[model samples]
Target: MHPDQSPLRARSAPRHVPPLLLDIDQMLDEFSRQAVRAEFRFDPDTPAVVTVEFLAERGPGVIWRIGRQLLHRGLTEMSGFSDVRMWPTLSGERPSSWLLLETQEMEALFELPTAELAEWLDATYRIIPDETELDGLDWDGFLLGLTGGPGVPGE
Candidate 1:
């Protein structure tokens, strides 16, 4: 088991949304879906990032770190670009959201319950509000780490 899949890790996360795997059969023109286990983690120390781990049955889980803002905005409308995209969807009986994760090898689509995700996102905001994400960041230390003792980028 991967360290990120430990019980303690899941218990420590602020929110964990149960995800559904949408199986799209384009050749047959049919759509089938089932529940899948995935963990969503938010760290107050990195207020702007959200971590998602897709658990596997016999191996380590797949992890992706997404921007919290992008997920929040996606609840209402389409957002994201390139490898990640999310948009609102009203299908079946529930108003859910569609998350598209693309890589060079393949792409996967998951259906997320909008209400639950929105509520979870709201809780994150209460912990660290928007626009104040950088309130406590140490700029000098960050720059120094980036440039290896920096006064300027090239100097």
Candidate 2:
């Protein structure tokens, strides 16, 4: 091994946290109750819309979909959770058009219109059809953090 590339140096190197990242733990908790829908498009100029849905509690991880395209199968160990990256554009600090969902073996990137689209991904248990529904959810499954807020970036 090169002397300059010491094992200690490599271990000490910091991972690059993006300028904005929606909390991953929050997202996981949010999905545990119900499926949330989001929209994305491959191209900016074109008007094609793809609907993405988030599902949870299947196993150790979550699931995602784009329209009728079922991303993965049922009861599978492999799952990918999404990270909403907030990009600083000329307009302001808004959620980036792209999202990265990754797992051990693979990663999928998606394009959405704006950062606001990530509002549905919050872990607050914000979407309750009725107050009674809350009684059945597993509140203990959440591993929340102090960062990130629903519908806002870098909160």
Candidate 3:
């Protein structure tokens, strides 16, 4: 779907792409495997970040904030480092991407449909193009917030 035609874009609100159902790679534990549902949320107000929420049967679940550009780059090639990493896999019958999320306690791997993710990223770009990401930022307010009020010591 064209980004402009998206209902969320029309309303100028955060866009929540439909839940992407993925299967947790059984390689983590040969005996235990299950489906994991995730939702991708993009806010035009915070154009640089994309929030990924892993849904659970109960409670708040898990949330990860990732750089928007990192994900876009991952769609075609391997991207990210440290705790998060993603890469496209053409070996499968259906083109998909492998996303790895690692923490001190454990690591999880998920296969995502490449085309669907690309489409959603396109929509986010349409809402707020990369070049204009800082256009709406409040620089003065941001500085004040960062410095705990008033002018910088040097100035």
Best by TM-score: 3
How large is the C-alpha RMSD of every model relative to the true structure?
9.3, 21.1, 6.3
Whole-model alpha-carbon lDDT for candidate 2? 0.33
Q: Estimate each model's TM-score.
A: 0.71, 0.24, 0.72
Q: Look at candidate 3 and tell me the lDDT of residue 10.
A: 67
Prediction 3 TM-score vs. true? 0.72
Candidate maximizing lDDT:
3
Please give the lDDT score for candidate 1. Answer: 0.75
Q: In angstroms, how far off is 68's CA in candidate 1?
A: 0.5
Tell me the deviation in Å of residue 51 in model 1.
0.4
Query: Model 1 compared with the native: what TM-score?
Result: 0.71
- Segments of candidate 1 deviating more than 4 angstroms: 1-30, 143-155
lDDT of 1 by residue, 23-139 (tens): 221111136665566677777788788888877767997899989998999988999999988888866687778888889997888877777778877878876888887788988
Alpha-carbon runs more than 4 Å astray in model 3: 1-27, 30-33, 139-155
lDDT of 2 at 136: 52
How do these models rank on TM-score, best leading?
3, 1, 2
Q: Which residue segments of model 2 deviate by more than 4 Å?
A: 1-96, 115-135, 138-155
Q: Return the candidate ranking by lDDT, descending.
A: 3, 1, 2
Q: Give lDDT per model, in order.
A: 0.75, 0.33, 0.78
